[model samples]
Target: MLKLELPAKYEALRQRVRAFVDELLIPIENASTAGTDLKPEIRARLEDEAKKRDLWMLHVPPEFGGQAGDMFSKIVIWQELGRSIAIPPRRWAVFGPDPGPILYQLAEHQREKYLWPVLRGEKKVAFAQTEPGAGADPAGMSTTAVRDGDHYVINGRKRFIGFGDEADFIQVVALTDPAKRARGGISSFLVDTDTPGFRVVRQLETMMIDRPVELEFVNVRVPAENLIGREGDGFRLAQSWITEGRLARHGARGAGVIERCLELGVAYANERTTFGSKLADRQSIQFMLVDMYQHLYQLRLMLYDTARRFDAGEDIRTESYLCKYFGDESAFHAADRCMQIHGAIGLTTDYPIETFWKQARSFVITEGPTEVMKMVVARKVFEDFTKTA
Candidate 1:
């Protein structure tokens, strides 16, 4: 049986998180952030506040001085955090260092050198996989890593890597066996930022206000021991990271965005007067609000179900694709409708609607585009449904 409702404890935790966002994050939502991150003073204060509430290190493991939060719990927290634009959608560290799950696959020695430093906030890591020709598909990647006696010489260019300029090391994905490609030829390597041939080419400007960097690796020799897992695990490893991201970041955050849009839209529609009556009184405005509410309801159910299944150790690759595209598209539509309802005020910085609109709009293309997600899901649909035929 599938349970959509959260457990008592989780529901309680969700309330706590929502309260934190409404009281703390929402009030400062309009304040200027420091380059996609919270300002030092603001971050310091919030960190202290979060610690006081025992809200710190929500995603980290218990052994690493974190709460070892579960998947559902993380989705709840992320959903609440999505309500405010004060926290950058992509780069956020106030909750503590999130080395990400891919690092957990590092070998014992690699863990000490890379993962431990990250857990201790002594280091940061950036994942490099996207290239000029590759965005969603890794089979077309052009980056190559040639194995030598003691090291692998990497040559590739990675684009749109978030926080690449500030990282201490990079989890670089390269073609280890050209014949296998994404099937079994790709490999992941940990390369130090100061390594001889590693260079950050430039920061790519984006409408989302987060500047992701482009990186160039020319004959970057990474020690053989730096390879994560086996030589042919790069594509799988990267996809695993991206898969969970679609669920937690895209799916959960989309639910939160829809909820927030509904909140803002309903409040304004009820209060703001139009040509003659309150915006809420207009059928056109009501229809948009209804649509936003419908998306929120559907997305929440799907996110909860998918997250629950994932927590139970189920493989949700196809479900994740469904959640990702539906969530991203829903949130964007909700934001667009909310903006329309708010009229010109929505576009101004006076309201968070504009930022929400922009962020939601960008999500439709970033993680996995809607069309790609739909294509993946369509394949699964045919696989499952045609089996009965």
Candidate 2:
């Protein structure tokens, strides 16, 4: 048996985070945070508030000066934070440092050099995996890492990497063996951004607020010691990072979008009048609200159930894929309906609906798109059911 309901403590934590977002985040979302990043002074104040509220470093481990929260608790925080567009969809670092999950896999020395600096906010890092020719398919990666006497000479081009230009170092994934590719040929390395041949080519602007970058690594020699885990561990490690990301970033955040959209849609429907009646009284408007509510409820259930099973030390990778596609589609559809319900205001920046709409739409395409996710799930479906038949 699995538990889907959040425990008492987690429920209480959710309410606290919800209050923090409602009081501090939502109030300043439109005014204080217009861009992808919060202003310096505003970020300082919010970090101070987060510390006071015990919301600081909720994801990092306790030994690393963080609260060391479980997946479920972290999801609770993520879902509530999603309620406000004030927190940028791409960058959610208000509470504390976000060193990312990959760093936690680092060895002791690697942690001292990379992970610790990141947790202490002394350094910033970015993951470089998506190549121009291999956005969704890692097996088609053209980037190659050739092992030399004591270093690996990397030659590759990566695109759509967030914070690539600003990062002090990067977690780079490359093909070490063309024959193995994503199987056993791939490897991940911690490369200093200033390494001789590493360059930030340019930043690509998107409809979304995030401006991801393109990078080139030509004969960039990284010390063999910088290799994360074993040589062939790159694909496995990247999958681990992505699985959790799909859970928290897509699954939990999408829930936040649905919850917020439902709130906005219902309020507007009840308040706005057209002709001789409130929009809430009309069946069409009511149906939209109902759909939003339905998506919210279903997403929350999937998110909670997946998080619960994940916390139990079970392999929930497939479930994470389900959460990714379903959450992305459901959230996008909910945003669409919310915008439709808002009439013209939804298209304007007056409400957060437009922001939600654009960001939610992007989720369906990025981070293993809906089609790829469905393909993975379809493989599992055939494997599990066809064998039984």
Candidate 3:
């Protein structure tokens, strides 16, 4: 009974993002495949072009020079960007730096200093909440920050931090009081990447395209003004940001991967031959294609429904988990089917399907593991049922 319709404005936005990806980002990503790192020169060139087109930071608020899109609009745009193996659209990288918990908690001066520069792409920031010891449980983080007269000295290690090495600012969570834990002991801080004692100990090469970093903080000093929100709201704020981000990743990026997989499958089916006939003529191939289509359609509907609910200001904590679970699983199914249709070529780098497969597999673990997401959904369902009973 869920309505699957998109507003005309959002549809148009989708097309715009799709066009940019097809025309610009795709080529850049194609060129960067052999190189382990995204070339700074190439990135600068593409970012410049994106800015010229007013496509700089699509998710940031308009007051900060971004489009200020709603959740629905973001879902549509990010889905289109995720359709290719290329560098994500310029805005995608800016997502973490944009409006979320950070923006809402920014002091007036802090907003003007850090947030605005970030929106303009003059500075880059990355989330650094995950640690070597703390994967899913932020409450167990060992990172500690003790307040000094004018600054807070931090000491800890963070791992699997996305874009951490390249970021100018790092958003980190540390324990200020172990007794309060997640309730009132944890705090979030924005630390300059160049601050003394903050170092990139190692870079983790993920199965996916981006290489995140493992950072070491040795008595890193951060101004007291760098604290985001209240001293103890770090865990709550982090949870909200992470939950929303997980939904976006699953719904939008997963949809894009599914679409790309279908494209690869269909292209192969039409031309690939076996037993003197095209693969498209084979009943087995046709069935697989149909099944893939079913999964894609189902995922798309769920993504839109969840996005709409989020935009309507509904509490989507449980729905977000459902979408993440379904979106990742469905996309993996589509990618596997598409690779099967391509035979050996799909396994090779000659086509993008192999990369897509790897990326999809990584999604099954990122944000939250698939098993963890399912448990969250189950708990929510049980709680709701008990309340009604």
* Whole-model lDDT values for every prediction: 0.87, 0.89, 0.78
Q: Which residue runs of candidate 2 sit more than 4 Å off their true CA positions?
A: 1-5, 387-389
- The digit string of per-residue lDDT tens for model 3 on 69-144 reads 5778778876887887766322356233454546555778687767777765588788888889988666899999
Give a tens-digit lDDT track for model 1, residues 1-389.
Answer: 12356889888888888887988889998784877678889988888888888888878878767885467887888898888898888875567888887997777888889999998789989988889899977678999999999999999899999999999999999998999998899999999999999899999988887899999999998999999999999989999889878987899898889888888999999999968899999998999988888788888888888888988999989989988998899999998999999999999989998999999999988867899898888988888888552
How would you order the candidates by TM-score, starting with the best?
Answer: 2, 1, 3
lDDT of 1: 0.87
| Tens digit of per-residue lDDT, candidate 2, span 98-140 | 9877899899989999998898889999999999999888778
Q: Give the 10-residue window scoring lowest on summed lDDT in candidate 1.
A: 1-10
Q: How big is the RMSD of model 2?
A: 2.1
Who is ahead in TM-score, 2 or 3? 2
Clashing pairs in 2: none
The local lDDT score (0 to 100) that residue 44 gets in candidate 2 is 89
List per-candidate RMSD values in Å.
2.1, 2.1, 2.9
